[model samples]
Target: MKFAVIVFPGSNCDIDMFHAIKDELGEDVSYVWHDETSLEGFDAILLPGGFSYGDYLRSGAIARFSPIMKAVEEAAAAGKPILGVCNGFQVLLEAGLLPGAMRRNSKLTFICKQTELEVKQGDTMFTQSYEEGESITIPVAHGDGNYYCDEETLKNLQANNQIVFTYKEDINGSIANIAGITNKKGNVLGMMPHPERAVDELLGSADGLKLFQSIVKHWREQHAITS
Candidate 1:
């Protein structure tokens, strides 16, 4: 599978994402700078975490206007798979690729540690390897990771199975403990945790590899029949 990792100014995790996809998954991966307007020959695009644009205006507010985001939005609209982690998640919300806005952590502190995430919806390609209600440890580091959406929107998201991941414990005061969500079509996913950090047992755990593997496996399955 070919993967593209988007990098904006101040993005620190792009290399980690690159290594996770290329070295760990043994997949073809490339970095797409924020100024680039095209995403050529890539099946999946990832927006890895970090403070984009120095988080000046807001976590992802300014980064949303970057040129590459237009291409990312188009790709996502066309049913291509896209994953956003940390500030990437913030960008998705700012870009309207996903619903809800991130707020300061309930305690107004920067949280950085390995936390457990509960798989709420496993039918999506991102979480298919795990069963619903299963918990997996993934590292989360952010100051504005608390997710908030209006009550009606939250209800709708639940009704549509758009809520994909929730905190296993009430670590952040995210509305409904939501840690991640997907678009209504399930093609775009945005989560706060650092799945790339959990890909290797040497770093900590290998539980996050299932997410990358699941996407590749699904792509292969679809391509096998089409080819």
Candidate 2:
């Protein structure tokens, strides 16, 4: 499947994401500047991590207004999968595409390190390659990585199996140790960790490869392609 990695001014992980998809996953991928409004032919959308708009107005606050986000919203509405990593997660929240909000790390510091993450639900299109309850380590780098949601939303997330990944060691104090979560429709995922950075063996692990594979497998199944 083809993918578009959205690029915003201050987005630093766009290249990493493109490499993961194009080189590692062997998929058709391209960089889409944040100003372009039409995502007419992409099968999936990826929002990579970075200090978009220099994080000037709180993580993803300003970047949410990018012209391309309109197209992203339209894509999400059409049931195409969207994955947001790190600051991209912040933007999805600000754009109202995902649930919850992020706050300063409990320690109020930018924590950057490899961290353990447990697979909470492997049933979705983005996580099906992982076994249920599998443990994997991925790198995380951010100051506002803590996630919070209302009690009702939390309950719904639990009931719907939308909580996909949880930190095994509470590295950022996210509620329920949430490292990643999916929208109710399972078409959008927002997570704090950098999976793209961990997709290579030289990077210390290839656990993140399964997440991308899951998306491709799901797309092929939905489109009825044998390749």
Candidate 3:
């Protein structure tokens, strides 16, 4: 399936995302500037991590107003897969495409490291390649990666199996150790970990490759059915 890696002014990881999809995942992929008005032909959308708009008014706050986000919203509404990593996750939350919000790390410091995560719901579209409760290592880098949600929302997330990946330990003090989560419909995923950075064994781990494979696998199945 073809994918579009959204590029904002300050986005620095667009190349990493492109390499992961084009080289590692063997998929058609291209960069879509944030100001672009449409996402017409892409089968999936990827928002890579970076300090969009320089993270001036809070991570992802200003970047949400970009013209391309309207197209992203349309894609999500159509049930197309959308994966947002790191600051991209922040943008999803800011855009209200995903629930919860990010806060400063509990330690008030920028952190960058490989973290162990548990697969919470492997049956979902973005995680089907993983076994339930399996442990995988992915790297994370961010200062405002601490995730929080109100109690009611947290309960809903739990009840709906929207929580997909959780940290094995308190890495950033996110509630329930939430490293990643999907929307209620499971079409959109927002996560703090940098899965694109781990698509190869030479990168220290290939665990993140399964996440991308899961997306393509689901798309192929759905395409076969519809076609």
| Candidate 1 wrong stretches, greater than 4 Å | none
Once model 1 is optimally superposed onto the true structure by TM-score, how far is the C-alpha of residue 70 displaced, in angstroms? Answer: 0.9
The TM-score values for the models, in the order shown, are 0.98, 0.98, 0.98
What TM-score does model 1 achieve against the real structure?
0.98
lDDT digits (tens) for residues 7-34 of candidate 3 = 9989988999999999999999999999
Candidate with maximal TM-score = 3
How many backbone clashes does every candidate have?
0, 0, 0
Name model 3 segments beyond 4 Å from true.
225-227
**Per-candidate RMSD vs. true structure?**
1.0, 1.4, 1.0
Taking the tens digit of each residue's C-alpha lDDT, what string does model 2 give over 1-227? Answer: 89999999999999999999999999999999999999999999999999999999688999999999999999999999999999999999999999889999999988999999999997999999999899998999999999999999999999999999999998888999999999999999999999999899999889898999999999999999466
Q: What C-alpha lDDT does candidate 3 achieve relative to the native structure?
A: 0.96
lDDT of 2 at 22: 94
